[model samples]
Every structure is written in structure tokens, then in C-alpha cells.
Target: MAAEIRLSPCLNDNFGYLVHDASTGATAAIDAPDAAPIRDTLQREGWTLTDILLTHHHGDHVGGVAALKEAYGCRVVAPHDRTAALPLVDLRVAQGDVVKVGSLLARVLETPGHTLDHVVYVFDDDKVVFTGDTLFSLGCGRLFEGSYPMMWDSLLKLRALPDDMLMYCGHEYTAANVKFALTIEPTNPALLARAAEVTELRSAGQPTIPVRLGVEKSANVFLRADDPAVAAGVRLKGADPIAVFTELRERKNKF
Candidate 1:
């Protein structure tokens, strides 16, 4: 049986994924930035919204929870650590928790960096991961509520996943991120080729996300933790790997 996963563009460039278990006819919305688009997509697909899986507590990521729940009465599953702040979380889940969407089971990964309560959903069977803001296409999220070391550790955890894992990120920021990657790894053939592809895709007004983990490992400067060139470029007058990662993120923040 085929597992159906549909993408619906929500607020600005944010994407909300509708993952359906074709075998069981169960559907779950990854994040609800806006209710209208999600509702429209559900209606269009004739899919019932059974669950709302939230990766983080950002308003743009969870803003439509109340509205969508009111309309569909779906269970809202969010990180247990931030339940006090999360407005409508019905199930407070953490690492090791398994969320079901139809016949698919997503294992929760507590990846804190963009936010202290951020989590990623890994569908092992499908080899797909929904990386909210912790891990982006070619770049990672800015250090907002977390520290550099924390972000680095979180990224390390994600980097351990299978190289072929499909990464579904939060936004359409790959083109701009590739531009920054080129600045750091100007001569990297993989980066150059990926940049060209992203440029062409953006020129056609298409989304440049859902990049593979292997592609990111080869082209993404942030994911190249041991690359000598990246290490040298990000190294301060006197810094270690963590420091290099921090400096690199700082440079990207300004870029």
C-alpha cells in the first residue's frame, strides 16, 4: 500500500504537511500555521484531520491549533516540556514517544536548538523526517531561545540519521541559504551544483525544500562538522569545534 503525504503551503513560505495512512485512512497535519489552508487541503483531499503534530511552539508553527481543533476536534500532540506555554496541547509527548498517523508511526526526536522545546518527527519506515526549524534545507535555524552548543548537539543527533533520510523542513529558504553556503564553500562542487539547481527552481517560483540528508551532508556547510575548510573558515583566533560551529552560525545570522 502507498503512504500518501501531501504538502500545503501555509503562512508566507511555511509548509504544512498532510500525512495520510492510505491503509487506515487516518490523516495528520504536521503543523498548522494557518487554519484556512489546512482546512481547504483536508476538504480537497476528503481526509479527516485526526491529529495535529506540533514540532515547536512558534506562533507561525502552531498558530492555527485552536481554530483547527475547534473545527475538527483533533487531538493536538506537542512536546511535554513546554505544555505550560503551548495553548492547546492534548498529548504532551517527548523523546521516544510514537505518534500515529493512519498506519505510519513517527518516533519523536527531542532536538532543541531553535527553541528549548523543539522536536522532530522521524518516520523510520518512510525514511522521512519532519524537521521543523531545528534543521533546515541547506541551513539550520537561528539561535533564538537556545545556545550555540545546544544547537550543535541537536544538529549532531540529526546528522546521525541515515544519509538517505528525506528532510521536510519548515520553510522555503533553501535558495537564500545556498547563497550563504557558496560564500563559505565557494569551490565545493556539490555546493555549486546544488546552488545552480536551487536557483533554477526558484526562478520558476517553486519550493526548494524537502532536500535529502545525503545532499545536505555533501553540500550544507553547517552539516559539515569535520570539513577542514569549514572548520578553518569558522575558527576564531582560538576556538574548538563547538566554537567553530557557533561562529559559523553567527556569520550565517548576519548573511
Candidate 2:
């Protein structure tokens, strides 16, 4: 049986996901944006919530954790927050830790950027990555707790993943992200095409997540800090990839 993933909307712009292992009937919620919506979805899908996997300490991501845990007794696995910022974190994992949802295994990556302790979950065999807010579709997360260099390193690590893997982020910011991406690479045909498609999906109330990593490499400026074309577009020719990334992130702050 294949892994069944359910992308759910929570809060105003946040997204939550529910992944169920078909072989073991074990289910996991990736960032509990809110409890009611996740509960509703679980009930609708007839899947039991056995685990709550968190990516950061943001309220929009963990807001529903307590409710869901109380209702389902699910184990909460979050970043290494010794202060116990989370309502309940059964385990605190860092880079290279392996978490399990039934027989399915997910490797934890310490992708600190948006937050100092932020992380991403990778189910290698499943070819899926729950990126949280570290890497979005066409843009990366805002630098709130970490520096440009920190975020850049985190993103580059994710860039090493298999090109064919599916990427699931933590927000419904695809259209806006792609819009901002155009400023850096307006002539990029792939970027332009993706922006148009995103416009159509958002207009029709459709999601543009679970995007292919390969597609993102071509379209997401943050992911392509090392690409010569992107560097040239930003007038930073011959500069280090990290320099280009810093400039791009600064521009996004104002965008």
C-alpha cells in the first residue's frame, strides 16, 4: 500500500498535512495548524491520528497540537525545544534523527533558518519532504530567527535531495512566492509559466503544493542561489552563491 497524504488548510494561509501508512494504518499529521480542521479531515478519511510531527515553534504550525493530542493521544515529535514550548513533544529530534509512522521511516533534518531550531522531515523511500517553512514553492521562509547565511545553508542542504521528490511546504503562499520570484528572473520561461499556472490555481481555490523539487530548482530563486543565470539577473555576477542568496532574501524582505 502506498502512503496517502492529505493536504489541509488551516488558519488564514497555513497548510497542514496528514500522512497515513497504508500498510500499517498508522497516521501522522505534519504541523497541526489547527485542530478542528485536522480532526474533521481525519474523521472524513477514517484514519487515526497516531503522531504529530512539528517543524517549528510557530503558533500557526503547532496551534492545533494540543487539541489533536488530547483527542487522539498522538505522540508529538518536534524540534529540540528544551524549554518545552510545545504543548506536548514526546520526542525532540535534531539533524539525522529517524522518526517512524508505522513502518514508514522519516529522517529529520536540522534546517534552522526561519527559526533557529526549525527542521524538515524527509521520507526518502516515499520521495516526499515536509519542508515546513524552510523552503516554499518559489520562495524560502523569511529570516526571523536566523541570518541569511544560516538560511542559505539550510536551503542548500535540501537542494541536495533527489530531484524527483515531492515537496510539501507549510503555507498557501505559492502564487505570491512565484510573483516575487519573477522580479529576480523575469525572463525565466519556467518561472513565468509557473506563475501563470499558480495564478490560475489560486483563482480557482486550488492548491499548488507538493511541487516537484526539480521544478522548484528551475523556478525558486532561493533554491538556485548557485545558478549563474540567477546571479547575473541580480547583477551579482561572479559573486559567491551565498552572496546572491543574501541579496535575494533582502529583496524579498522588501517585496
Candidate 3:
């Protein structure tokens, strides 16, 4: 059976997701930003929360885990957290690990940069990925606990995924991200069209997410750091892709 996915906007700009399987009545929340919205979503969908899959140990992502777990007695899965900042974890996963919510299997890919223990869930059968804070719509997470090179490598791993995959990120920052992207690839037709679309979507108060990886590969500047045009935009022509990427990130920090 096909998986049912729901997106819940929570806590200012954070996004919470629930992936449900009908065959087994198993539902997993990708990240619990807050308990109220997720609880409401669960109640509305008539789906019981059986699992809480965390991508990292960030407070915003795990804040609701405890409450939800207490309410549903669900298992909590998370990446290895040496800091002990997160709540109780029933399972600690790493790269290449497969986690199951009912019969739905999600492969874990370690993607540090947003945080040292960050990971993303790729549901191959569903052609969907939950890219926590590691990747945004047209941008990437800021280098907080990881270096530029580390983050770049992580991004490469994601970029290598199939183009048709549908990507869901942790925040609704597409409008701002696209605005920054325009600074880098102002003349790129794909980005221009995407920007217009984002503008219209935001004007209607709609969420700009669940974008296809193929579309992001064409317009996301962070994913295009290897392109010569991107290098030129940052006045780093003929420079290595990593150098271009670093320059772009630094500029974005200020932007």
C-alpha cells in the first residue's frame, strides 16, 4: 500500500511530518516541533502515533517527543547524541541503517552540518526523503557544529539521490532562500520561474515544500556550487567547487 504523508507547520517556521501506513496502521512523525499541532494532526487524521523518528538532537525538532511518547507510548528513534540533549531514545541509528514504521522502511543517511548527529530518512519505496535541517528549499543549513567541507560532502550525498525523489525539509524558508539564490544566479531561467512560483505560493499563504529533487537540482544555488555560473556569480571563476560553495555560504550568512 502507498504511504500517507501529512505536513504540519509548527513553532513559528518549523515543519512537522507524519508518514502513515494503512496496511498496519503505523504512523511515524518525522520530527515533533511541538506537541499541540502534531497531536491535533494525529487526532484529525485518525492515525495513532506509533513512532517518532528524529533527524537530529536539536531542541526544536525533539521538543515534542517526550509529550507525544507519553501520550502514545511510541518508540523514539534518533541519531547518536553524545551531548545527551535530547529526550529518551529507544534507538540510535547511523548511516546505512534501515528503520521501519510498520512495513514502511526508511533508510538513514548521515548528513552532518546542521548538527554533528544529523541524519535524513529516505523512503525508497515512496520516493520521499525527510531532510531535517541539513537542507532547505533553495539553501542549506548554516555551519553550526560542522565545517564547510563536511557540509558540502553531506550535500553531495543528497544531490546524488534520484532526481524524481520528493524532498521535504524542516522549515518554510523557500521565499527567503530563493531571494538569496537570485543574488547568485539572477539570470538562470529555472530559478526565475521557481522564484515566481514561490512568490505566488507565499502570497496565497501556501507552504512551499515537498519539492522534487529534480527541480531543486535545477534551481537551488547551494546544489549548483559546482556550476561555473555559480562560481562566476561569487567572483570565484575557475575556483574549485568547494571554494565556490564556501564563498556562497559566507555571502548567505551576511545576506
Candidate 4:
């Protein structure tokens, strides 16, 4: 049976994911930003929480782990490096480690740009990746604990994945990101079209996440590090490639 993923909104616009294996009814939660919503969602779906996948140690990302574990007695799986601060961790995983939710297996990808402990979960068979704060719909996370180059390298690793892979980022920041892209590439047809689409979606109060990786490669300025036009734009602005990406991200942060 195929894996089923459900998106649950928690703590403002942050998303918490519930991934389940349809065959055995085993389930895992990806980043518990808040416990109340997670508790309510589990009850509504009639699914038991078997494990907690912690991507990082941020309060918004790990705040609910204690409460959820106390309520459900589920194992907490987090990065080995961050377990010292994450007291609820039951399984400490690192890059290349595999964790299971029923029949589905997710490979751990260390992506430490948003935070030094950040890790992404990729379910190859399901063609989906849960990129906590490392990657966003059209933006990347702020380099809180890592440098520009570190963040850029992390993003490059993700860009190497198959284009068809679905990117399930942590936040819903597509509209704002597209607006920033317009400042850098005002004449880009793809960016223009995507901006319009994001406007409509936001107006309708719909989420613009789980955007296809292929779509991001084409239109996402952060992911277009090697594009000649983008490089030229950076040169014209008297900035290097990394500086260009950082400047773009900073603009987005303010947008």
C-alpha cells in the first residue's frame, strides 16, 4: 500500500505533517510545532502516533514533542547531534539513516543551513521530502546557525534530487517569495506566471506548498545558482553568486 501524507496547520502558518502507512496503520509526525492541534488531528484521523520525526531543535519545530510523547508514548527520532538539547529523543539519527513509518522508509538528509542540526526526511518510494526549514515553497530559510555557503551547499544537495520529487517545506511563504523574485528577475515569464497563481491561491485562502521540485528549479532564484542569466544579474549588481543568493533571501525576509 502507498503512504498517505496529511498536512495539519499549527502555530500560525507553520505546517505539521502526519505521514501514515496505509498497510499497517503506522504513523509518524513531522515536526510538532504545537501539541493541541496534533492531538486533535490524531483523534480526527483515528491514527495512533508511532514516532516523532524531529528535523531540528527550534522551539516551533520541537516544542510539542514532550507533550505529544507524554500523551501517546511514541518514540522521538531526532538528529544525533541535537539529542543533548532534545530530551524527548528516543532514536538519534544522522545522515543516511533510515527511519520507518509502517512500510514506508525515509532516508535522513542532513541539511544544516536553517539550523546546524536540521535534517530532511526523504521517502523515495513516495517521491516526497519533508524539508523542515532548509527549503521553503519558493524561498530558503534564514541562515540562523550556518553560513551562506553552507546553506547554498545544502540547497544544492536537494537540487540534485529528481525533479519530479515533491517538496514539502515547513512554511507557506510562496507569495512573498515570488514577490522578491520579481525584484531580481522582473521579466521572467515563469516567475510572473507563478506570482499570479500565488496571488489567486492566497486570495482564496489556499496553501501553496508541496510545490513540485521541477517547478522550483525553473522559477526559484535560490535554486537557480548556476543559471547564466541569474549569474549575469548578480554580476551587474556587483555581487558574487553567494552574495546574490543571500541578498535575494534577505529581501524576501523583509518582503
**Maximum-lDDT candidate:** 3
What residue pairs are clashing in model 1? Answer: none
Q: Sorted by lDDT, highest first, which candidate order results? A: 3, 2, 1, 4
Q: Tell me how candidate 3 scores on lDDT.
A: 0.93
Off by over 4 Å in 1: 235-239
- Clashing residue pair totals per candidate (backbone < 3 A): 0, 0, 0, 0
| Local accuracy of candidate 1 as per-residue lDDT tens digits, 1-255 | 255778888988899988888788888889888899999999999998999999988899998999999998899999988543676788988889998877799999998889899999999999999999988888999977888888888888889999988899988889889888877878888889889989888899887867889988888878775677787655453456677787788898888
Flag the better candidate by lDDT, 2 or 3.
Answer: 3
TM-score for each model:
0.95, 0.97, 0.98, 0.94
Query: Which candidate has the top score in TM-score?
Result: 3
**Global lDDT of each model?**
0.86, 0.91, 0.93, 0.85
Better of 1 and 2 by lDDT: 2
lDDT tens digits, residue span 1-255, model 3 = 379999999999999999999999999999899999999999999999999999988889999998999999999999876674768789989899999999999999999988998999999999999999998989999888988889999999999999999999999999999989998899999899889999999999999998999889999989888998899999999999899999999999999
In candidate 4, how many Å is residue 155 off?
A: 0.1
TM-score, candidate 3, is: 0.98
How are the candidates ranked when ordered by TM-score, highest leading? 3, 2, 1, 4
User: For residues 1-255, what per-residue lDDT tens digits would candidate 2 score against the true structure?
Assistant: 267899889999899899999889999999999999999999999999999999999899999998899999999999995753777888999999999999999999999889998999999989999999999999899988988889999998899999999999999889888778888898998898888889888889899988989989888999988899999978999899989999998988898
